[model samples]
Target: MKELEERIRREGAILSETVLKVDSFLNHQVDTELALATGREFARVFEGEKITKVLTIEASGIQFAMAAGIALGVPFVYAKKKKAVTQSDKVYVAPVHSFTRGETYQVSVDQRYLNAGDRVLIVDDFLATGAALVGLVDIVEESGAELVGVGCIIEKSFQEGRGLLEAKGVRIHSLARIAAMKPGEVQFIEESGNRQLIEERA
Candidate 1:
């Protein structure tokens, strides 16, 4: 995950104490090679879990989830933010609040895609609010699937997201964990259990 940390340091925009904009590379315009590498990281981290399916919320989570499914040789499913006519009538639904969008969505997954027999790994782009992932976890519990763990591309370690997931006993692994951030300065938790500060130059 050093490469990912490096990318964030070099390309990510620190807008505020609570906002980091990675759209230039991570989201709006993705780096395919990096995305695949993240999948490999998730696969390697959860290699022994025997995952049967990958789940994610729609939009930002789709690519990473698909990459993970490909690495694990399984099909990926994404919960629709808006139920479509093609969406399943019988589904597991949960309320999700998007802090970035200032809105709430009732996300859902088709009953046919998940059940008691499947072991699931949930992947997503960021872990800040824990809202969407918590909703997905609720759906997984509703389906009776075994949740192996959650894999995140980046995590704001200072936030309540990690705490919320831990309270629910959900295991989480994030590639780049930000200990703190602000305009022109960011700190990341190193693998050695220490924080490394990076200062942006003008």
Candidate 2:
């Protein structure tokens, strides 16, 4: 997690008070080593949960979910943002509003990949709006699968995502939590027991 925090500080671009772009290493051009390390951390944190599958929304969340699946020795499933022609009719669907894209879309997962007996661990790139994640949670519940927890690479703590998920009784673990950010500065709410703060400015 320290490495991740360092990367964010060094390479992350603070576009605004509400937007921090980490495309250089986290999402677009991914650092595979860092991603795997994050997966291992999630696996360690949720060691006893007996997770049977890793679930995420397609596109950005796929890599992290796949890494988690590899670490946990389980298969991963991604909810498609749009239904495909080949996809079956018997799928669990949930509506998600993307604040960034300014649109609402239906995310879904095939019923054949999930069911009542499985335990699911959700993973994602960013935990900001919680809309996409909440949709995944809904689908998991609809399938009657046990929700183990959620693991995120980066989280904007100032946002309502964490609060929304917590209100639903969901456990979340994020490697880097941004307490606040601005055009050229960022502050991280330390996760370590000491509660030490880490601040960076461009």
Q: What is the lDDT of residue 46 in candidate 1?
A: 99
Q: Tens digit of lDDT per residue, candidate 2, span 120-151?
A: 99999999989998999889989999999999
**How far out, in Å, is residue 15 in model 2?**
0.3
TM-score of the candidate numbered 2? 0.94
Predicted structure with the largest lDDT when compared to the true one: 1
Which 10-residue span in candidate 2 carries the lowest summed lDDT? 193-202
Clashing residue pairs, candidate 1? Answer: none
Show where candidate 1 strays beyond 4 Å. 195-202
Candidate 1 per-residue lDDT, tens place, 1-202, comes to 9999999999999999989999987889999889999999999999999999999998999999988998999999999999898886999999999887899989999999999999999999999989999999999999999999999999988888887898999999999999899999878888676633322210
Score every model by TM-score.
0.94, 0.94
Measured over all alpha carbons after superposition, the RMSD of each candidate to the real structure, in angstroms, is 3.9, 3.3
> Candidate 1: worst 10 consecutive residues by lDDT?
193-202
